[model samples]
Target: MNNRTGCEDPYLNYVISRRPFGWNFTDPPVFLPFDFEKVDPFYWVSLMETNWKVAFYAAAVYIFVIFGLQNYMKSRPPFELRKLLFIWNLSLGIFSVIGFVRYVPGFLFVLNQPNGFYKSICVKDGMDVPTGFWTLLFAFSKFWELGDTILIVLRKRRLVLIQYYHHVVTMIVVWIVGPLVEPIARWYTVLNFFVHSLMYPYFSLRAIGIRVPVFIANLITFLQLSQMIIGFTVNMTSLYHQQIGNDCVRYPISIQAFSLVYGSFIFLFGKLFYDSVIKSGRRRTEKKLL
Candidate 1:
């Protein structure tokens, strides 16, 4: 029960290996005993790895399109595409739910395996999970998610700097990590999918004129800020592990990049939560007292 790497199982074979510079990586057993190849093929994965530039170019175009469309819509009445919005948000919610269900367990199972949390986060692996197929899917999903911004523009909602910043930075991070098969960073993807599973559905219900509880809206923002805080902590731990020469396989430079991004996210999400929830709620209370 070994592959080319001579480990005991396919999981260990792909993840645990000797790297240059005297570093080593080891992984736990697969939660489900099946051949990774047996998993369904994702067609666009190869193209993503081979023609990485396409992601960059597409990201550039996304920025241009966001600005252009927003400007074009400025003079016109906002189209309340209620039905379309409902469908779009619901579909994305379902997609995020599926991603969360499929991938989070796989990663959590990895964490539960030997070597503890730090090793699980720091150890780099090859495309262990079917060309890193699900991970790649999550990365590509970011592109598909640009539709969220477009919808906002069409609706004449103000595009906050953090919104576009998150989209662009996320695409770049995923593009870099997806090809590298950086399993550690996929934690970000898992958390995002979980959040979106709830967030998108809430948006869909609102679009359809359903009354969602105000607390639900505040909870979503809190969860987003919490995600950033936890993520930043994990990256910091990874950085610390790498610094001590734990023999864990990691891309040092990439870890640095991720840490910086997570730091930024913490500030942005915190600010957003404060403005939209705390300050707004306080203002409402003041008005009620008056």
Candidate 2:
């Protein structure tokens, strides 16, 4: 299929033809690193296809560094790099907002058309467009987000298992599935971008000593849990399509892996909400009554 024009699939052609207001569908914006008009987006696709295994290597190194830093910090004073953490979260938050803008219009445009729902789940065209460029960056950004853990460790904060596990699994899964260019990836990318746009900025505010309300934090966790639930639903839809002999372009193994990861997230986040919010509220209420 021609990734540039998406001429082979009529639906994809339709999607590419209509440029929504404020959306960059063809070329990378000036702010982005590469000039997509000069460089084929497939060049990066080829790199991802070939070097996907490198995510595993990077994850291994990340694990080593985080654990080693944790042990080293046990005997020393924690360095409070408040300014740096603020910058980091703000940067990622901005990037996520950009990604959300780049990805969502096309997704909504596709979903509103006839048979659009199925096509959104199965069609894989327009890889040389702006969506493709941002998708590549989205995958790579997983690695950059690992820095959040490093910041936590340096601050002598308690690093929970869910935190690092989520980072590592997310990095690995995005790397492995990105080159496949599955249609379902649109949902994953869009929802994640939307969540992070709120999440990272909230963290940035806290980093700078801003007193955000408790409810806002709860809302963030709620959005994250919703994202996970939707992710599991998308994977299940893929599996159902495959079972019915539809032409969904996802591997069975990848679908299974995604299901497991998302399912685990549902449980982990639910526990977190219960422990931090519900139980804590009950405790405060009981103390008030006493």
Candidate 3:
């Protein structure tokens, strides 16, 4: 599994062993047709690490597009893109579910190894297989997810500061840090995939005029709020580990960005849940007493 040098199998670089189901098999799961390192586009992982201006420019464009669409739709009636919206959200929901299934197993497998979670994140290895490929796809998907703002703008829905804040900051941070497969990132990605797997499909059903219980909707918001709180805690722990030189590897910038971003989500989503669910529930209870 690992050598005395504190490294893992050179070819299966992140695993102690894929025993049980994969006991006889020698290789890790392969999702891509070719090795990710051999792929040309993956070179951007290192390139973007150095050329961060590209990420900034992409963020700028996303911001401009969202605001531009909102302004353009000011005088226009809200487009009834309900069918299209259902399709969009459904697609995202399906994608999130698939990501959950594919990545979570590999993620847990790595974690199950002896000190594997730390080693997987802290070290870079050529043989880490499909996890790298999925991470790239997940990062790339953020660019397209900017369309979520566009949809809101077209539908003439009120875009709060939280909405813009969540979208823009996520795009920037995810793009910049996506290549860094720090162990904390596994938690972030899995949380997102799990949340979206439920949230998006719920919204998609609503888009199609299918009414679900209000509690289901409330649960989604609650899950989001919980994720921010938990994620913040985990991130802080990671930073502490890094500070003590506990073999944790992460970009200083990534940790800093997450601090601000996750911190905002905690407050914003907390307020939203209180306003939309908790307060409203209290009002209904008071009215019933009358």
Candidate 4:
């Protein structure tokens, strides 16, 4: 082994991350933070093996909280909340970019081919790289995203079914799937970078009071669904191919959990898309006929 990295451990934040950011991913293993004492030792891992149970529990909790809050907000007049929501979403968006930008160059230049040789040759090339930073960033971003709920709550916005469910399930999913780790983490990050590159700007536009065209909204949803479809297929294939198990890296069980969530979300959200927009048009047409 090389004598030393001549630098501190890349995961110093794991043990000592402070707030506004957090100590979330500084964890027992992988790139996640160590000893997130709020949950049990295997809380993250249990989310994978018992996903449906956990997912439903999460969904139920959010539904109750969101709807309860919505009813409470009904008594109050609408407060001007755009600025706060905008800043919150924008901050998360920027954090996503920071995490994405930090990793892309290395993924492209070093791991372009993405077979066994890429890992080997990339390491030997003496790149000024941190081995596990992407995983760390991806892991860290989940904690940052908890702010999504804060905005909805503080701004007294109506927490719709989809938004509430998305927030809660994603919080649980990232905890379970460990989306930022080795093997699968690379592809997940790349795909997320691509997705968020589009997703965030859409938020930014709407935040600034620009109306996103209906077609644009539909296209964005389609792209998101497509991302999940591709991710599930590719990850399953990678899971199978890597069964040869020559240490080319692997996703751990958490990736599989995320794949299942992606599959479920695509199905649920696809239906949601049809129900919300297509049915709205159908209902309008039927009313016109009557």
- Candidate that scores best on TM-score: 2
Q: List the residue pairs that clash in candidate 3.
A: none
- Count backbone clashes in candidate 3: 0
TM-score of 1: 0.82
**TM-score of every candidate relative to the true structure:** 0.82, 0.86, 0.82, 0.63
Greater-TM-score candidate between 2 and 3: 2
How far does residue 6 in candidate 1 sit from its true spot (Å)? 12
Candidate 3 displacement at residue 12 in angstroms: 8.5
Question: Which has the higher TM-score value, candidate number 1 or candidate number 4?
Answer: 1
Residue 1 displacement (Å), model 3: 2.9
Worst ten in a row by lDDT for model 3? 18-27
Model 4 agreement with the true structure over 1-290: per-residue lDDT tens digits? 12222234443432223211111221222223233222322333334445535545655765676567667777787656787767766776776676566655545644543463345221222122222344445554655555566557656765555665556766666655552234455556666766776677678778779898877777777777777777677666666556765443445565567667778878877786677667766887899999
The reply for model 3, stretches above 4 Å from the true place, is: 2-44, 114-128
**Candidate 4 local accuracy as lDDT?**
0.55
Clashes in predicted model 1: 0
Model 2 per-residue lDDT tens digits across residues 207-275: 999999998998898898899999999899888988999887788768978998899999998888888
Query: What ranking emerges by lDDT with the best candidate at the front?
Result: 2, 1, 3, 4
Residues 1-290, model 3: lDDT tens digits: 33212234343433324321122221434333244333433365666567656667877897898889888999999999999999999999998998887667666766676776564455332223445555666777777777887899999999888877887788788877766655567678878888989999998999999999999999999999999998888778778878887866677987898999899999999999999899998998999999
Between candidates 3 and 4, name the one with more favorable lDDT: 3
RMSD of each: 4.5, 5.6, 5.7, 8.8
